[model samples]
Structures are given as structure tokens and as C-alpha cells.
Target: MMKSKSKILVLDDDPNIVEVIVTRLESMDFNVHGFTDPGKALDALRKDSYCVLVTDQKMPEMDGMVVLREAKKIDPDVEVIILTAYGSIEGAVRAIKEGAYDYISKPFEPLELVTKIEKAIEKRELKQRVRFLEQEVGDSIEYRIYAESPAMKRTLAIARQVSDSDSTVLIQGESGTGKELIARMIHYESRRKRRKFVVMDCGATPPSLIESELFGYVRGAFTGAIKDKRGIIEEADMGTLFLDEIGNISPEMQTRLLRVLESGEFRRVGELKPKQVDIRVLAATNADLEAKVEDGSFRPDLYYRLKVISIKLPSLRERKEDIPGLVQIFLSEFSRKTGKKIMGIDKRAMNMLFNHQWPGNVRELKNIIESAVVLCKGTTIGPDEILLSGIREQKEENLNTLESQEKNLVIQALKKANWVQKDAAAILGISRRVINYKIKKYNIRPEKVN
Candidate 1:
């Protein structure tokens, strides 16, 4: 039996031909509708959702071209197959040029007709599946992270655990470390998943307008304020508001934000009455808030409030083990988008990726892979195609400076304490735990280094 829920509309103008086609289709367990008049067939198409339309080329009221065009108007996706007794090249070409799926000769076998119908239905179903997959992948945030390293795993685990709460979360990480992506993951996995997730870049917005953007203004509150507007916080009511680069906001703005976090109430500009909302705030920053607080720039109280639940993200260099997996994800995405058959990266290219320090983190790696995929002509990506012109030199300089500073500190501490772990920890004014962590982090083998 045919597994499809498809109904075939057969319009041949002759009752005998229509009967034969309908009987054959029904024998194969297909739902078949027969029509003798082209006008009646077109009217039926408008009323019902038929999968395939088999219409005779020559008719009294209208030709196959008219039926095809009218049927397409009713359902653009409907597959229309033209049946012509003359089988003339001009007629076949015209039928096809006018949007007919395929032209079938009148003397064709029943099996041949069935084959064409089956192929047409399969094509439509394939297209529908592709659209669905695209939407699913586009909307999924889990696919965006694409992590394999333990550091990333730990970060994701923390995000998931805190998603159920409404407490303000502070995410501290370097630029392009997927801070926004993690913010989205938290929103999508939360109880308020169905609500809006609004993002505001505190650093990008001008100081003059940042307040108005967060707590909107009323009509005539200021120049160009013709109408009352809703701020991002209000828009994110019963949802999540992600404030990126939170450290860049002014001290006054920080105080305002503190009030909102404490009471969930804020008034629109020029409004006396306070408006209440149920919003979850997730703030991200790359700056050292402790240092900022000490310098009397960021409010210490606000900093403490924001850090109630803090998650520090590991940079790409710290989690280099995840690079191969991330590269694969980007390759698959770009290959699907560009209709390319790029299978994987060569060892030389992969090694180059692993060696390079990604200061911009995952975002930089993704951009590099995208550029390579676009420029590559072959199936696999090679080192020659991968461009790292300006980034490589800067990364090398930064890496050298960081390593030299770390090596000097470790060497000095070891020398001052005569290579004793406890003495070294005491001299550095750090705990034994921290000394061990740094030793591993910097790959400091003091005995072999000297």
C-alpha cells in the first residue's frame, strides 16, 4: 500500500481515460479524484489540497497551460503533470516552460505514469524536510556552543544549573568567548524560555541615550520624544535581559541598575510613578570588577550584587582541546550554506589552527574557518588556503610576553624558597593550591627549566 497521504487529481476531459487512470492509482492504494472538465478540475484544486495534478493538454473550456497556471496559483507547491495525446515537441516544451512538473504522453504505460507521480511526491517531501531541518538548526542554541574541553563543559553545566533561578548572573570572560551565546543558552533552557530575550550592549550605546534606552522616555520628556517608548527592560518583562559589557556603564547608571535589581521597579524618564516588572538580568563583562571597585570607579555594593552567582569563562587558548570540534561544526555549517562538499581539514591546516592563539576566542576561529571555506576550491581545507596574516604576529607577541612574565615569577619564587613548595607558596603570598594551579596552567617545570 502507498504510505503517502497524497491525493492525485486526474483531469483528462474523456471519461474512459479518467476512469483508467483513477482505477490504476486506486489499485496502488492512492486516493484519486477524476474530472472530465478542466474548469471542474481547477475548481476542485481551489477547494482541496491535492498532492499531484495530472491534467489533459487539450480541453474545451481551457488548455493544460491554463489549468497548470490556475492550479499553481491555488497551491504553488502542487506538482502538475501534463498529459498530451499529440505528444508534439512544441506542446511539451510549452507545458514545461509554463510550470508543468513533467509532460506525459497519452500512450504511456500505467507503470510509467506511476513512476513520475512517485518521483514528484518524493521531491516535494524532500524539500519540506530540508526547510524543517534549516529552521531547527537555526533556532537551536545548543549547537552554537559546540564544546569538547572540560573547562567549557563546566561552564555549560553552571549555566544550566542557574537557568531555573531569577537571580542576577554575572558572566566574566574575554571578548568573543561566547558570553552572549551562553546567555542565550540560559534563557532558552529556563522556565521563561517562551518569553523574550532582549540584549543591550552597555558599551556600544552612548552614555546620553543609554538611560533612556534602558528606562524608556515619555512623550515630550526630551527633544524628539514625540511618543512614549518602551525600554529593553520592559520588553524583557517575564523574560531575560542580557547586558553585555556591563562594566562600561557609568557610575550613575550602575546605581540605577542596582535599584532595579533590588526592587524590580523603575520609572520611565519624566514619569513619577514607578513601573514594576518581573525580569531576570544576566550581565557579562571582560573587565576586572574587583580592580574597578578598588579604584572607586564601579560601586562595590553593585559589584557584590552582580557577583551573587558569577561564572568565569575559559578563553580559547585555555581550552585549546575544543578547537577541532569547533572547527568541524563551523565546517558543516558553511558547507551546507555554500552547497560545498568540504569534508574536513588536512593535518597541516588543523595543526596550524591548534598552534594559533585565538585572542578573539571561538568567534575568531569561526570567522577564519568561514573565510577558508569560501576561498577553498577542493574538498578538504589545506594550510595554504588558511589565512592568518595579521593575527599570527600579534598573537605571538602577546604569547611571548605572557610566557616570559610567568616564567620569571615562577623562577624567582622557586629560587627564593630553594625549590620547597611550602616556602615558595609563602614567598609568593599565595596558597599552595594557587601555586599548584599556576604551575599546571603555565606548564612550569622549575627543576628542568634551570
Candidate 2:
């Protein structure tokens, strides 16, 4: 087992320059490998992973552009910086079009060269971090199941175990449950990680274009077909395809999709010979697909085919135990993003979050946190920061029944305690448990107390 190092392969015909570059890069704490021959450099690239390739544009056998093109073929993500003479600026521009990161003109200051190298490396590191994070998020099969509930934990475990296989997946969940995230996770974790992951929202897109988009169309296939285009199935060949809200797709499109899944062969809009592709289908639905099949709205065979490995995401209310954690997570994330220094939510604000029936599920909770983060002023998020319309509307309706003086006193207590019953009880010189029973009887939301 060979250890990995941050190696930079320096390919320049000039021996003195290579030596100078190598010595400087080594001093900057980089592992340097120099090559005069372009052929040998290509071979080294194949044998090892180099963080960046610094090559002169004018070489003996192959030029820098040619080398860069070949290097990209080996590893498309490897950053390439071209060294061009002062006269070859036009050529450098063309090289950049072919995917060179940047070009340095000859007769440049040594400090300027070092600065360019530093910037290039920094950019590469940032790209690498984003890629790793995206992969981690995409690879986690349980991301859709955000709760820490035992049922969700078990569901995630099953998803992880089955992600390596090429089996079809059927994701069942209510509206706003993240069924699509689970499908993305399976695709990212599977053998087809490098290929395309296409998503088709069966309910959103019109039925007329669904078939063409899924299968693809050739030049002159229709009035708008000016060029040959690969269908989504072909685009997703050797990868995964996510069909969202599958129950809403038309019967014709469903039949076409079923045929492709069954035979791994389908024709383009105007093409005769059937094209074959290796694609994994991941289908999701908020509707009861089995009921739809029974009622003749969905195909029975397709339903069974997609349900080879089934998983369902639970609603947020059913997993109320995880609400505090979820709320804290959302607050931190939103605060950081919005540049707010909100330390934590007040006790009253916390009560309102937990007691409210989250009809919109986790998505609603996240939005609420984001909105609060935007409006919050100081370090701590107080009850006044929660501006939920439902809570405000209910509070306004109840305000008219009480005398102005009495209402003011109750509002003062609620606001002072930040909505927690025990704290409010202490302020009013009452027992904690009695305050709790009163909270229930009065239907007073913590955020609504003021």
C-alpha cells in the first residue's frame, strides 16, 4: 500500500528553470517531481496523482495544450497551469478554452509566479472541500430521514445495506418528506457514482414532453429537434434516474418507461434501432401508489418492478423527540448563513416550536428558523423573533375578549418568562405544574403569550 502525497509534476524542458521551480516548491512544503520529456511526464501522471501540472507551452515533441488535453483525459479534475512565452498570449487564451486553469507568460517576476501558484492551489483546495462535502451529503442514504427516531434509524440502516446493489428502489412518504434525497443518496453510493443522476418530476412537467425528455430525441425528430440529443435514460446510462411523484405520470409515459426498464432498450423520437443502457431507476411518491394501481391510475407491473427495495420516510410530528435537536441544528445553520450571532432560542420560543403541529414537516421548521435568523437582532433569539402568522392571528382574536388592563398583565408575565410555564409560574408566585395545566387549558402558545 503506497502512501498518498501532495505531488506536483513539473514538466519544462529548461533544466535550470525546473531546478529553480522544484527547489522553491519543495521549500513551500510540496513533493516535487520534474520531467523534461513530455512522454515521461504523461507516464508519471498515469502512475501517480499530482495535485497540479505546471508545463511549458512549447515543448519538443508535444506542446502544453496537447499535454493538458491528455492529462484531463486521465483525471479531469487535475489543475493545469500553462507557461507561455510573451508572444504566445493568443495560444494561451485558446489553451484556456480547452480547460487549462491559467497561463503564466514568460519573463514574469519570481514573486508573481509564486503568487499565481498559491492562488491556484488555494482554488483547488476549495474545490476539493466542496466536492467532498457534496459527496458526503449525497452518499448518506438516511439524509431524507432527518429524525433520530428508532424507526428512521432502522430505515437508514436498510438503505445503506442496499445502496451497493443495482436494484430498483421505491420510496414511499407523505408530501414534504425528503424521498428525493434518499434516491440521490442511493445513486451517489452505488457503483454508478461518476455518471449522471437525472431527476424527472412526473407531476410538474407536462405529459407531452415527458417521453421525449426521458428517452431522448434525434435530429429532425420533431419541429424543434435541430440536433440529436440523448434521452435522460441514455444520459443516465451506467448511473441512476430519479422519478419524483411517479404516480402522476401519464399512462403512455409509464408504459414507455416500463419497457425501457424491462428490456434496457429504447428508441429515440425519430430513431429506428433501439439503444440499450445500464440505468438504475429510483421512484418516489407521496401518493398511495398501491391504491392508484388498484384503481387503474397506476400500472400494477411497474409498481411491483419499482418496489424491489422499498423505504419510507416518517413525518416530523411522529418524531417529536428529535425536534429540539433539529431546531438547534437549523438555528445554528441559518444564523451562520445569515451572519446572525443568535446564541439560542428563549424558553417561550422553544415551547412554540415544539407544540406547533408542523403541518409542513421539516421543511417548514427550516424555513421558520431561517426567517427568525433574518429578523433576530441580538445574540439570543427571544419569543418576539417568532413571527408565525397562525400564532399571531390566534393571539389577536383572543385579545378582544379580555379587559385591556387584565390582558396587559397576562401579556407582561408571558413576555417576561419567555413562554416557559415554570418560569412564568415563578414570576407569578404559582406552582410549576399548575402553570403547565393552565397553559393547556388556555391553549396559549409560548410565542403567543405576549
Candidate 3:
């Protein structure tokens, strides 16, 4: 798909420089609007929303830094990148501290400028998404697992179809993919809807206490068992038990849980008699249980038993098309809670959101939007309102090609160094830290490099 281009606001007093940048960026598929006058560019800033604002450091009436500051007042979320000459490095750093996304040194490479611009746009979009989610999902009673993409629609359909069943279901996806919400939906829509639905995070509990907590104990069973207690399983007898982060369970806990699944019975501590319950099991994990099984961290039998039916939630990056809708919903939500009358997002901000690789998924998106809404002073959110400068640090791409540069570099290094970390780092003239980071970031296989 030809991804939608982010809008670029180019401000420079020199018509020639403005013309060159506009043609170059537009040729790269960006939507570019330029102004040779700082005042005119500020007018454009007030009238239109831009994903990125590129301005010259030294202008006739007003400097680029001054223009950028004013541009932020008009639209806080708009990303600003300054173009600085040789001696203006200090000024560029000051601009960065004042909220500019990046600075391009004069006489820079076309490729380098393009990479920085791409990163700036990506960072801006991430901020906008975070703002939208925070604003929309925080206060709504009709909370939905929002997904308009085909892949997400399919997953939602599967979730709905299996929600009413008594069978155990395993939800697999990366963290922030809304596994808990899916589990809640299943319980809410099931035959046991009116009964209590208890959640137990296997990953949170200490291994020593997981057994006593899940299958309670009699009075004086242990040091803290001064009174008789109802276990989580008993507490949720006619309801549903949500086992979150299921892959983190220890082998011993897995065995105990396995027995419960098989017999629907568990005995309290210090009691010989077994108690029977009719609770349904719904488990979720971001880990690959199958891979864990291969490595013996998880039991194969337990994995099979829990995964009678599995639903995998797609990552946020895999469903970029749904971002626009998600953003709107979040805006309304945050505006209500924060008492901010924020009305809408700038078109350019929305474009940036659709291009970001959201490593943190929906949860991260919600946090970003909430932060922006809290910090915003107007009815509309602009690019600078979102804090996404660090997002680019984690991106695997060259910020331009998404694939070419890093992939090729890793492959070449692996070939020359026989895939050894120290050797590869030496071949690339970078630290082992950088090499290791790249290897993981690109999911590169040294074994396959040759």
C-alpha cells in the first residue's frame, strides 16, 4: 500500500531554499506547503495543521526558533525541525530543548535529511495516537476493543463466537493487545454472566503463595491461616477465572492447575477432601507457550489443555488503518474526563499516527493521548502536544526505508563476522551494545546470513 503522506510545513525567508525543500519532500510523497516569509508561515500554521514544521534558523524579521515557538503556541502537537548553518549548532540544541523534534545541519545529505524527516513524522504520529487513546477510552462505559481493520475484525468475530462457551480459551498476543478485555468480554457474555469473574495474574503472584491462594486453606493451615478462607476457585465457583500471563506459571503451579482443569476439583490446604467447582477457565499470555514448552519452561500437556481455542490479537502496527477511528474515540473520552473541550486532531497529525510502529500497542497509545490532553490548552490538538521523541529510538528502520538499510547492514556484518557478536560489532565499527540491539531489533538471524 502507498501509505498516506504526512503534511510538512516548510518556513524559510529564502524562496530558493523553500522551493528546493518543497520539491524534494513532495517528490518523496510528503504533502508539502512552503512560505518564504516567517509571518506568512505563522499564518499558515494558524490556518492549517502540519505533522512536521521545518524552518530556517536565521530569518529576516523573525528567527526560525522564534517562528517555531509561535508555531507551538498555535498547535502544540506540531513537530518542529530546525535547519541550522555551521555556527548555529548551539541554537539548534536550544530549539530541541524547547520542543523541536530534530535539527538538520546545513549542507546535509539528502538521504540524511529524509531520514530525520521520516523519524520526526513517525514520532509526531505516535504522540497523537497516545493523546487520542487517553482521551477516548478512560471514561466510557461502553468500552469496546476497538478494531476496524480486517485482521482485527476476524479476531473479534472469533472472540464473540467462543465467548459463551464453557471450554477453556487461550488468548495469545503481545502485551497491550487487550488480552484482559477479551477475557472480560468472554465472562460478561457467557452463561455465568451474573456470577463473580475473578482475575488471577499468575505472573504477579509469588510461586510459594500461588497454590494457597488459588485453592484456599483451612484455619491454621499455615502461619497466616488463622481463619478459614475461601480460595479464588471457590469464590468463583459459578463464575469465570481469568488466568492472565498464564505462560509465567511455574511447572508446579501448572501441574496443580492442570489437575483443576481435568477434575474441576481442588482441595484446600491442610484438608484431605477435594472440593468441586464449575468455574470456567480463560487464560491469556504474550509469551509463546509452545516455544516455552520446547524449552521446558511450560508443560506441553498444560499448553494443549488451555488452548482448546486460541485467539491472537494483532499488534497496533499491523492495523494502522484503524488508528484514525481510535484517535477520535480517545479524544472524546479524554476531553470529558479532563474537562478539556478538545474537539479534533489536525489532519497532518493523523497522517503521522498511521505511519508509526507502535511497539507498546494500545496501552502506550492511550498513555500518550492522555498526556497530550492533560497538557493541551485548546480545543484542537497539534503535533507538539504529544511527547514522542523517544519513539524513534526504538524504531528498526532508517526512519525512511523501513527495511533496506538496517537489514542490509546486519546481514553484511553477520556474513563477515560469522555471526559472533564481538566479531560482528568489530566488522561494523560499532559497539557490541549497538550490534546486539540491532540483532534483536531486526530479528536478524546470523545463521541465515550466509
Each model's lDDT: 0.80, 0.74, 0.77
Question: What TM-score, over all chains together, does every model reach?
Answer: 0.58, 0.58, 0.57
Residue lDDT tens for model 1, 27-105: 9988889999887787677544577999888888788888888898877778998898864757877878878889888
After superposition, the stretches of candidate 1 with alpha carbons farther than 4 Å from their true spots are 1-143, 388-450
Assess the local accuracy of residue 155 in candidate 3 as a C-alpha lDDT between 0 and 100: 90
Q: Write the per-residue lDDT of candidate 3 for residues 1-450, one digit (tens) a residue.
A: 111346788888888888888888888888889988888787766544467889999988998878888989878988998999998799999999999998999877777877888888778766865665464345454357787899899998998899878999999987667888888787778877656678887766766888888888776789978755667887677679999889877888899899999989888888888877788999999777889999989989999999999999998889887787778777888888888899887876666566656655776566557666877878877776753311222345453553454456556556646678887665444457656767887888845655
Query: What ordering of candidates by lDDT runs from best to worst?
Result: 1, 3, 2
Q: Write the per-residue lDDT of candidate 2 for residues 87-190, one digit (tens) a residue.
A: 99999999989998888998767677667666766666668657755754653423634657886677777778889999999998765556777787777678
For residue 229, what is the lDDT in candidate 3? Answer: 62
- The positional error of residue 385 in candidate 1, measured at the CA in angstroms, is 1.4
Which pairs clash in model 2? 215-231, 216-231, 348-418
